[model samples]
Target: MIPTVVWGTGNVGRAAIRAVDAHPKLQLAAVLVHQPAKVGRDAGELAGLDRSLGVSATDDVGAVLAAGHRAVVYAASGDVRPDEALADVVRAVRAGAVVVSPALYPLYDHRNAPAEFRDPVRAAVEEGGGSLFASGVDPGWGNDVLPLLVSGLGSVVDGIRCQEIFDYSTYEQEESVRYLVGMGQPMDYVPPMLIESVPTMVWGGQVRMMARALGVELDGIRETLERRPLESTVRTRTMGEFAAGTQGAVRFEVQGIVGGEPRIVIEHVTRIHPSCAPDWPVPPDGSGAHRVIVEGRPRIEVTVEASDEGENRSAGGNATAVGRLVGAIDWLVEAEPGLYDALDVPLRPAVGRLGRNQKEEERA
Candidate 1:
């Protein structure tokens, strides 16, 4: 079994613990934390597992890295702390621990990634003789892998579109929703996520990744946005009441225009309240789903609706991300040491993974 350490204990981090613990190929080495409150806690308890794994959580990242784990699942958020997260991941790789993380967005497709952000990570991999992989649920599989795979099913394809339609009220990340995404904020204020060329900076890589997967050269990337305000006061279980007329929902599209048209596109329809975008596309279950639509000869459309513990779609989606990264540990360890993304490494299915999700299994 590969010795694996999970960093962070938040949404994705907790899921990482569960994934690494359950995987037959991985051993729960240690969990790294940033909060003092989480230190010295049992890994299973922190991950909400059925029993303790006897591995304690520590905030000392250096000691954990120095302990010689084969792989590190870096779940720390890069939304607000990209630089810090980059440095941390580099330190892990330099310590000779193969890294798989969603924190570093720039390395999602390192080949076309900006030199400013990609060079440091590239250098770290070269010096450490370790590998790095960056991905997430949306920008990860929902964008690149799923689109290209769906396109193969159709005989002729004119355009490919990926959509993330969900309600953010259940997702309790206040800073991300309120500030980064501009949810529940005033319309006059421009959210940092949508500022000119920022969407392109974050999601444009996914567009390029998809284009490269489909073997097409894009003309250029483009962005179009729309905002809607809540008509009446609404309340959420996690977040408190949102006043009427504030920013209630946001819909945006980052298109990879080819041949003078938006051929390859990534669209997000997010609403603080489900009713905000009644007319916009939504999950048939009224929760959320990753959709891939191939507009062509077959006009194929596929939607994935998944959930984790007790119908927590947010947790379920993140679990899939954890599963994707953790499942690739052995593959990343044996492969040539370099930076990788979804296209570079295949997500191999674990033989015992099915038994772990037996409840969801029987439902099928």
Candidate 2:
């Protein structure tokens, strides 16, 4: 297996670095970073590992790519800089690196992606002779892989609903929470995430992917949203305070219409405070969870709750997304070069991890 270069040192990038370093087959070749201050830091420090991983972070993208790393975990934040992220992934693939990322939303299900989003990546993959796959928590395994796998357990399937119930207080990205998602915006202000066809553009592909996997034809896609304002001012540990009458909670659904009904759905129930949305769903056992519920026959439901140190729900979700990308490196290396989505990239079996914990114990 070719070593992996982890690009970006954000939430997802940090997880990807740790995942690649700990994997039995993969090695962390380099940590690509944009910040000059992080240029020479050890990979372990960036990823919060106990000891240094020999690889150092670098700002020189080309030099790192040319260093013979066969794969890159492109974990840069896509919410704000999608085009930049896409261009970087394109360059990595063209540089002969198989790329796996959650950055490019359109490529999560490249089959349904618009031409503006899919065409360039397709062409780049064809030219580079390297594979590209994009996925994330909500649009990644939660909706596509988990739901379709659960569908097999049911004798008669009516509707498949995938839900991500999370509290965003610990989520550190301030700009995103305040503006992009409109978490604490005034009630009159429309959150960018729920405005117009944004939800469809972001999540419709997941619905379509699930439908395709279940052999169900979708007639169309629809979206619905609801928001709740804070009864009084409340402060969060990370993103500061929200004044009274501002947006505090939001529930939205991206529905896949089947025979004029919303059959396959990807729904989100998010809040700044746990108390805001009492009626809305919460993770059964923890602060957050990704759940897949089948509405038919036996009525099967599966809930996934992951936790890292400090019980950070956001980190858990980030780790899952990283694993989905890094674990697929072996498969991606052998698959035909092109743009792939979760549907094309099946969930891989657990790669037996060794040598990491023992080292940690020794250091401690």
Candidate 3:
């Protein structure tokens, strides 16, 4: 069994702990936390498991590394000193442990990443004889892998676009709302300059990855950002006074090259409020709708209606991302060394079904 340590006690971290607990080939060795309040607490309890795994959360990084684990999952907030978090991962890797993270900034278009991080991280993993991989639902799977999969259906493809539309009122994380969707700003307030660069940051590698897969070089890339107010009061667990119409929406676009010319375009749109969708050419698919449009010799459009399993749509996406990550721990640990995105990671349908089985057993 692969002994694994998990960092953070937040939503994604807790979910990862639960996944480690149920994984057949993986064991929850230790839990790391930065918050003093959570230190020494049972990992199971933190994840609402109501059972102890004989492992407690600790704030000591060196002590956790010395515990003889082979892997660590870093699920903490990227906005909070990502460099420090990267250092922690590096330390774990130096101690001979592979690392997987869901942090946002690290995977934002590899071109924009500082060489200081890219080189050191790779060297650390190699020095320790371990590897590193990063992935999440949005840039990880939704935009990158999903589009690549859609392209498989056709031989000649002109362009590919992926869209994720859902109501953010149901979202509970303040950082997620503020950073990913640009919440708390006026409708007229344009998204931050960094927000406009997300497509290049998150999926820029996707453009490159696809370019390599399709044997084409991108001529140039383009991006745009826009926002509008909400039309109705929305309820959420975190905020009670969202007002009748107070929210913002943001969009990102990337056009890729073919034959030394621009031929493919990819777009990502996010809205924090209702009616914020109407202002855009393509309105929000409020029902957790995801669409992939392929324009080529054999034109095709595929739409998927994601399950509304949770109280709100945003929660459902979070849950899906968390669940999938947790379920894949066993397979992920065995993956070969070097950087890997979602496309590089294969999903084992049987492993996913195990999660479904566990959920069913819990409900029963």
Candidate 4:
């Protein structure tokens, strides 16, 4: 079994622990946490599992990597500390641990990523003979794999569009939801994410990845943004009341222009309250959906709705991201040492998990 370490214990990291424990071929070596309180805690307990896994959590990243684990799931947040996250992943790679993460946005398309971000990772991979795979829900699969796969259904596809429509009221990341996304901020206050060129910086890789897969050359990339104000104050259990006229909803698109048209688009319709954007597209049943629309002869549209831990879609999205990242570890360990994009990694089937339930029943 491949010995693996999971770093960070937030939304993504928590799910990573559970995923690693359940994987048949991967053994939970150790878990690394940033919080002092989380240190020395059992992996299972940190992940909110019913029972404790033998492994414990630590903060000594250098020592953990030095132990020579075969794989590292870097589940730390990169939004606030991109440079630090990159350095941490580089250290893991240099230690010869195949690293899979959803953190580094720039490295999602390493080939097209800027030299500053790509060079260090490449050097680390070369130095230690390790590999890296970066991915997430929206930039990860919603725009890259899902759209490209769905486009195949059309004989004459004219355009491809991927969307993330979600209500953020249940999302647990209070700082990001309230500050980074400007949920409670006045309309005049610009959220960092909606700043000029930021959308392109974040989601453009997915656009390019899809365009490349479709054998289309993008003329350029473009961005569009629209925000709405709360009609009335609404209180939440986690976050307090969002005052009237505050930023309640945002809709934006990163368009990959092909033939002078926005042929490939990555759109996000995010709302702090469901009632804020009644006109905008919403999930069919719940609070969130990752949708892929192929606008062509057949006009195909597929919606993916996921919920976890008391119908929380944000947690559900994070869990799916963990699934993609963790699921690729075994394959990455056996492959050549280098940075791999989403398209480079095949989404392998759950071969071993097919009979897992039956086996559990037998054991019981």
Candidate 5:
């Protein structure tokens, strides 16, 4: 059996723990936490599992490494500390552990990522004779792999577009909602510089992955971010009240270019309340949906209505991505090592089946 260490005690970390707990070939050996308050607690209790797994949560990374685990799942913070987390992954790889991470920037924005972020991890993994793989849901499936799947139906291709529309009210992550919806920020808060260069930071890699897969050399990418004040108070499980007239809705559009011409456009919207913008197209379900459109010999469009469970139920897009990563770990471990994006991964029904069965078994 593969002994695994899970890093972080957050939403994705908890999900990873549950997934690792259920895998027949994997054992939850340890959990590493940065918070002093979480250290030395039962891993199961930390993950809301009433039963103990014989593993304890600790702030000691070295101790966990010394325990002789074969793999580590890095499900820590995805925002500001991603680079640091990647460094930790490199350390684990150097210590002879395969690493699977759901960090956002590394998996999608590899080409333009800072040397400090990418180089050390690459060097460490190579030197240690280990491998690292990163993936999530949006860039993983909706934009990256879905377009690749659609490409199978045609010979020539013109352009590709992917979109995700979801209600932010039900999402339980305050930081995610604030980040995506631009809440509690000035309308003029010129989005972070990284966002401007790479199309709003949320779906940059999705566009890049599609362009690369189709052999279309992109000249540049452009982004447009817009938001409006919320008309009424919005409530979420995490955030009780987003006061009326606050900056609570956001719409982001990214366009990919080839020789100064727009070839592909990807759009994403996160709203705290429903139908905030009537002019924009909304999914029929009002929950959340992913749509992909391919322009080629025979133009084809496919739309998937994801269930409001697992990651989709809360935490915005990150949760869904986390779920995808947890589900794919079984097959991903055996795949050849390299930088893999969503297009490189397969979405098999069996993975979902396994996840559901595991959850059911846990309850039993």
Candidate 6:
């Protein structure tokens, strides 16, 4: 079994712990949490699992690395501290641990990443003979793998669009939702994520990755954004009140232009309240969905909605993200040391997990 450590206990980290525990080929090593209160706690309890896994949580990064774990699931939040997160990943890679994460955005497409972020990771891989892969839901398989897979069903694909439609009311990140996304803020307040070129900086990699897969060269990339104000005062369970005329919803697209036409696009329609954008696309079943539309002779649209920890779409999305990263650990352990993108990893079936449900049935 591959010895693996989950770093962080937030949204994604919680799912990673449960995933590692359930994986047939992996063994949970030590969980790393920044909060001192979480130290010495059982990994399962930290993950909200009923049973204990015997492994304890620690804040000692040095000791965890020195213990020589085979793989690391770096689930720490990078939205607020991207530089520090990158440094942490570098430290793990240089300690001879193959790492997978969704923290660093620039490195999502390492091939086109800036030299400052790309050079150090390359050097670390060489130094310790380890590998690193960074990916997530929107910028991850939702755009790259899912769309490309659906495109194959079409005889002649003219254009492809990947979309993430969600309501952020249940999303736990308050600062990101209120400030970074401009939700619950005034209409004139510009969210950091929607500023010029910022969308390109984050989701641009998905566009490029799709173009590369389709064997097309993009003439250029472009961004377009739209924000909507709440019609009336709205209150959320966690976040407080969003007064009338405040920013309640946002829609944006990062398009990859090919042959002077926008051939590939990654679009997002996010809202603070479900009622904010009635006309915009929404999940088929619930408040969140990742969708792919292949505009061709026989147009195909696919939607994925996952709910975990009490039907919370945000937690569900994070769980899927953890699934993607943790599932790739075994492959990274066998592959050569280097940096990799979503395309480099193969999506395998749940061969071993198929029987897990049956075993649980017997146990119960």
Each model's lDDT comes to: 0.86, 0.84, 0.65, 0.88, 0.69, 0.90
Candidate number achieving the greatest lDDT relative to the actual structure: 6
Candidate order by lDDT, highest to lowest?
6, 4, 1, 2, 5, 3
Worst 10 residues of 3 by lDDT: 104-113
Which pairs in model 1 have colliding backbones?
none
Per-residue alpha-carbon lDDT of candidate 3 for residues 1-364, written as tens digits (9 for 90 to 100): 6888888877668767876767666678889998999988999788877677778899998888887688787878665467787787677777777777777454534444568777777787687766666665552556566677788899888877766766565666776676445565555444443456655665566666666666776666666555556666555556444544455555656667666555555566665555666655443455455667878868778765544324455545655565566655666567766655555667566553444555335545
Model 1, residue 117: displacement in angstroms?
Answer: 1.8
Q: Which is the better candidate, 2 or 5, if ranked by lDDT? A: 2
lDDT per residue for candidate 2 within 1-364, as digits (tens), equals 4688899998888888888876766777888999999989998899888887888889998788788688999988888788898889888888778999988887777887889878877777778787898887553889788899999998999999999998988787788888988988988898777897988888888888888888888898999999998887889988789887888999999999998999999999988888787888988754788999999999999999887646888778888878888999988988888888887877867746544543344446
lDDT of 4 by residue, 172-258 (tens): 889889888789999999898889998888889888999899999999999999999999999977787899999999999999999
- After superposition, candidate 4 runs with Cα above 4 Å error: 355-364
Better of 3 and 5 by lDDT: 5
TM-scores of all predicted structures: 0.96, 0.95, 0.83, 0.97, 0.84, 0.96
Q: Name the regions of candidate 1 deviating beyond 4 angstroms.
A: 356-364
lDDT per residue as tens, model 6, 29-57: 99999999999999989999999889999
Q: Which ten residues in a row have the lowest lDDT in candidate 1?
A: 355-364
- Model 3, TM vs. native: 0.83
**Top model by TM-score, which number?**
4
Off by over 4 Å in 5: 48-54, 109-113, 137-139, 179-181, 190-195, 198-202, 307-312, 315-320, 327-338, 343-364
Q: Candidate 1 or 5, higher lDDT?
A: 1
Greater TM-score among 1 and 5 belongs to: 1
Residue range with the least summed lDDT across 10 consecutive positions in model 4: 355-364
Off by over 4 Å in 6: 357-364
